[model samples]
Target: MKKTTFAFYRKTMLTMISLGLLLNCSALTFAEENSNTDENQQVQEEILVEQTEVLTEEVAVELQKEETVEQSNKSIQTPKVHFSIYFVAEANGEVTGQTKFDSLVSSDLFSNIVTAIPTPVANEGYEFSGWYWGNSYIGSTSSEVYSYFKRGAALSDLTITAKFKQVETPKVHFSIYFVAETNGELTGQTKFDSLVSSDLFSNIVTAIPTPVANEGYEFSGWYWGNSYIGSTSSEVYSYFKRGAALSDLTITAKFKQATPKFNVTVKFVTEGKGSLTGNVTFDSTTSDLFKDVVATMPTPVAEEGNTFDGWYLNGSLIGTTSQEVYTTLENTKLLESTEIVAKFVENTQAQDPITPPTDTPTTPPTAENPQPEQPVINEPVEPVVNNPGQAQQITPVAPEVQDETILDDATPEVINANNLDTIEEEVTPLALGHDSWSLINLVLTLGIAALAIMMVIGKKTTNDETRKVNKNAKVIGCITAVISIIIFILTQDMSNPMALVDKWTIVMLILGLVQVVTSFINYKVKENNEVESVNC
Candidate 1:
């Protein structure tokens, strides 16, 4: 054989072998694909069989429900609401009524009420409080027609109880008389009547006694006879209850003599055509008596050749001296809100000049109560000319006299709402003179309650919009809590930690802390839930 022929045959055999190997691989792949297809078909058949079984079960359930409905339709009758009326507190009554879902709708509520029952009669010395349907007070109605069932309640077996309570008897009258300087002297300014009527064991409500302010004597604590009532603080509020034994309520405000000093207001009131050297209003101070208070009378500048006369006190001639200072303090009857007048006579001396006399007394400016500027406050007009072109000038009374504010820092404001008595007549100590504090407390309480309600509403919300709003609620709650805490801090004195332990402060603090903690916890829980959902 030839070499070329042999080579060609070998190459052909090699090609055939390669082709057969390729075909075997293709066949094995095809067989595997067929096996996979069979398995897939089997799985599909099983899934179809499960789906058919589910459908069949659902159909059966629906058929059963339908059959039940049909059977119920055959036996269905008119729906009647059941209600049982029972007497409470030894009362007797018979009540009967029928109510339906028509009463539940808002449009048909009033028209659908079946009020045909009679009210219960209570025993002697007892008054019916009200009827309780599902443990709710619906108010007491003593008419012949009474509602056996509540108007908008669902059709369920309800028990209505007619509650009765003992009749309240009138309280024995008593007097809450005050003793300051003397008995019943300042009580006339108060609306607290002598014939006071209250409950048998009600609390004793005393108006904040602040009107009796003495010049040198400080107001001490109130006393019942010799016994001292608690809390001598200037802003102390009463929370004491009245005793069961009725008697005259006498609260005495004893004043210790803090100082022997006194302030006297000396007004040079114009009686007979003369002008003072300065403003008519003046202030002078003295210890113990009027003689000690040497109030220098302003030199009188008489017009039309008139002469200055001697000063007179209560129509009696005081003295002709420039500085009239009495030796003994007891001789000077000077006290709070005292005024003095110096008269000017017409030509006491014929040779007197038009100007003020040389012997006329002149008041020197003191360091404490310095003479104010000549022009009055809010002055729209020119400076007052008492008499045309006179050396002594007097400030004319303003169209509206600007009241001067005299501050006694030693004495606290004891006048409460009872002084004006214009505020709400609430019985609580907090409302006595602290209406603003009370209002702040009320607002904080309502805000806390609202935040709690919002939290509960957002607790289980799942909608995207609703969840977003819920997330924002935490921020709002946090802000609200912070505000409450700030208010608590600002309102309290915080000197003694115990001083800040009032009812409002405690309640607000607790509520604020709880709000912050719960809001943080809620936010964290929601974040964790979101993370878990993302991971899933």
Candidate 2:
């Protein structure tokens, strides 16, 4: 800009000097060439000579600029570029401070250097935003302004624009919190990493985070309130949509301590016709790190004609009780395979089992009176006994049962294999060694008692008769007591040999003992009477 102004002033001053010299020379020439009158010559010379006072109204600055550019183009080889900055219709700022530079100049070498582009001013109620080329904001002034003009070929006319907006207002950012219980945590959350992105304020949406629980614990679920939501997995998508309002609220991820459940099984150890009580199995167990149980156990049930003996734990019988209300094995024990069973024993108090009559002859037949052969039972096989080929029925004795209670009358035995050739005789279904009473044994005991009663009734007592009667009674009582004791021992369960406190066996035993005592008393009385007779 300075160079252009200096050039203009210098050319104007030189033009005035050249005109002054020409005027002085032209006045002298006009006086020497024509020796006419001073007045006439003066008029002619006045027209020829130039005046010293110069007019100031010169060529237009725009015209001078054009002429200077044209002259420079012809002299210089550098290409020209037209650079400009202006405001668009929507711009709310002043357009005055557009950039200024020399109108006509060479390249950067000879041109006035431009420091920076002036920023546009904004109207009241508005603020200057930024300078934009088209759609991009390039700030108040272009950084490339230094080189913006020098590099472009073809007089670059860049029409830069500016934008403005209402005065500033405070802005708010978004954040969220996903907190877990003591033993749990969010899937990807770390102390350094944020729950939401870069503090986003709008259009905020994110995937629902999964919760993780430590060992021995389970992730109950995510909850907004204190109440449980009853879910263990995260939602398939985002919990909130893009347009939903978001805040810095917290959603709790709840967890629970894990517990294990065990399978419980209750078993019935009886088969004698009866209904059983108590569950066969239980799938309930404690929920803790340690093992302990406080549960009500199942009761024992016995069917009709049978009594509930007791409850059993594993394989051992709990005391001789009706039922067990709770578990016997607990606290670290019976944590795995546990078994509870209900034990039952049949009632044997009913007297006199009905007997099936056999077709045996009234008396043992001798060789003189040969009896016809008895019919075979269950088959047509002939008897193989050595004496008259007489076959005797022999039933097998049952073995002592264990673990499970066996039914006494399960099946009647045909005969012992060792005595297969013996004649098939009628046998009772109830065998010895079982807890039930044998029908044959019951009948034999009753017969002994009846025989003793008949012998004592309606008999006049002499000394010999009295002595014989007392002696016979003593022998009978001993036999009765021995037989009753053997039968009772045979019918006992070997598993619990000493548990034979049943009423039937005790009553029978006492009856035999009473008869023995009575015989002793009778003998004492007879001795006393004999002594009195001797004294008289």
Highest-scoring model, lDDT: 1
TM-scores vs. true structure, each candidate: 0.22, 0.26
Flag regions of model 1 displaced more than 4 Å: 1-163, 170-176, 179-184, 187-202, 209-223, 226-248, 252-536
lDDT of 2 by residue, 404-473 (tens): 2344443233234345676765333323344444344354456546545543552434466566766666
| lDDT for residue 262 in candidate 2, whole number 0-100 | 55
Query: Each model's RMSD to truth, in Å?
Result: 45.1, 36.9
For candidate 2, what is the lDDT? Answer: 0.51
Q: How much is 210 displaced in model 1, in angstroms?
A: 5.5
TM-score of 1: 0.22
Worst 10 residues of 1 by lDDT: 391-400
The residue-by-residue lDDT of candidate 1 on 1-536, one tens digit each, is 34455456556655655665566556556657777676655665565556556655655665566567667865884644343333333353333333222333232332244433344666778776777765677556633214433335434333456677777775547645556753222433332343335523233444555535466556566776787875352333332343342666666667665544466665665566676686556555536355444444466666676666756666776665455524322375554655456667776442222223344333333333233353432343233223343223322223124333233432245444336555653244332333334444545656675665667665454557546756766766756766674665555433322331345756675676677666666666667667766887
Clashes of each: 2, 11
RMSD of 1: 45.1
lDDT, each prediction: 0.52, 0.51
- Give candidate 2 regions above 4 Å deviation: 1-174, 190-205, 227-239, 257-308, 312-337, 341-536
